[model samples]
Target chain A: AQSVTQLDSHVSVSEGTPVLLRCNYSSSYSPSLFWYVQHPNKGLQLLLKYTSAATLVKGINGFEAEFKKSETSFHLTKPSAHMSDAAEYFCVVSVFNDYKLSFGAGTTVTVRA
Target chain B: GAGVSQSPRYKVAKRGQDVALRCDPISGHVSLFWYQQALGQGPEFLTYFQNEAQLDKSGLPSDRFFAERPEGSVSTLKIQRTQQEDSAVYLCASYWREDNNEQFFGPGTRLTVL
Candidate 1:
């Protein structure tokens, strides 16, 4: 079985401040991890993915996450927060056994000026 | 050049009514996927198709949900006798190949069952 856990249900940050959204995963095999963002009523957009090639993955909009095998964690981070960054972020893990992807509940991010 | 597209951006149905949602994948895409997203929740996988073959439907919540892609280009998801619990956004996504990890998602159809 594969599953993802996002530590925060909601995160509020002031503009220009550092942003962090924590996520952890559990999988039996070597997993492919991903981070996606969804704006208000929009569809999901891929932020980045770690397919075992690189432990440090860079994504769109200056966002990035480090895959730590020892910690079982893939946490997204951004140096500075922008108002447009306000959205829901989901951490996902793809099962190597069957190619099915599992998503975490999600973390809602709020950016304040 | 266009991404995945879904029709009936919003649908309001009374309980027990049937509804059909459509999805048009990107040109030449070989894999299509359907997912359901409840309010404030992440999208849950519903089914998957490779070309015209329905490879997986294990994530479907119940038998009431049926999906098909006859010609391998356009697909439809039909929900029969919809219940209030069926109210949610139905999302469609597609990838160039089954082995590809990146998927392009559509805006989705918001289904509301009263």
Candidate 2:
């Protein structure tokens, strides 16, 4: 019953510009939200997670995400883009008391020099 | 010390051949997971294990896919009669019970069935 939708399949941003990758979710209960990043030929790395705590969550590499329950959205953002930030990003939602996660299709970020 | 580890970083199997993949979780981790990721897509859960118990396998595609974590330390996923559709990256993840859903993933095995 829980699912996540990533709005953009691909996003391009110039270096030093702000970046936004939108995601939305549907869950029957209060859910745990997460953002993960995967580089080419690498494993997924956790960027951040929200477990009913503060609405705004900060993550590694100057990345952050805001959890908006009203909008059913948890969109990831960064103040400035860097070349190393280019990767595939996934939005995930996990139901309360459940260990399994439903992942979005993913957003590919490309940072331009 | 070490994060999750998976064997056979890449494999190419002929159709109808059986293949086995391996995973070694972090020391003393209580949960292990397997997922399949197609090209240009997010990873999809294939199965889950808590300790040595196979708790959930609802995401496995068919009866030909089998997974086991016999001693609670290492796990193996076996696929019988490989098909072209089965070609994808297989990922393994694990985390400690106290970590509260923080799953660390290994570099996945890229399987290509021809």
TM-score of each: 0.98, 0.98
Q: List the residue pairs that clash in candidate 2.
A: none
In lDDT terms, which candidate is top? 2
Full-model lDDT for every candidate: 0.93, 0.94
Identify the leading candidate in terms of DockQ. 2
Q: After superposition, how far is residue A40 of candidate 1 from its true place, in Å?
A: 1.7
Clash pairs for candidate 1: none
| Deviation (Å) of B108 in candidate 2 | 0.5
Per-residue lDDT of candidate 1, residues B1-114 (tens digit): 478889999999999999999999999998899999999888899999989999999999999999999999899999999999999999999988555688888999999999
Cα lDDT of model 2 by residue, A7-100, tens digit? 9999999999999999999999999999999999898999999999999999999999999999999999999999999999999999866888
Per-residue lDDT tens digits for candidate 2, residues B1-114, read 388889899999999999999999989998999999999888999999999999999999999999999998899999999999999999999988734978899999999999
Candidate 2's displacement at residue B92, Å, is 0.5
iRMSD, all candidates: 1.7, 1.7
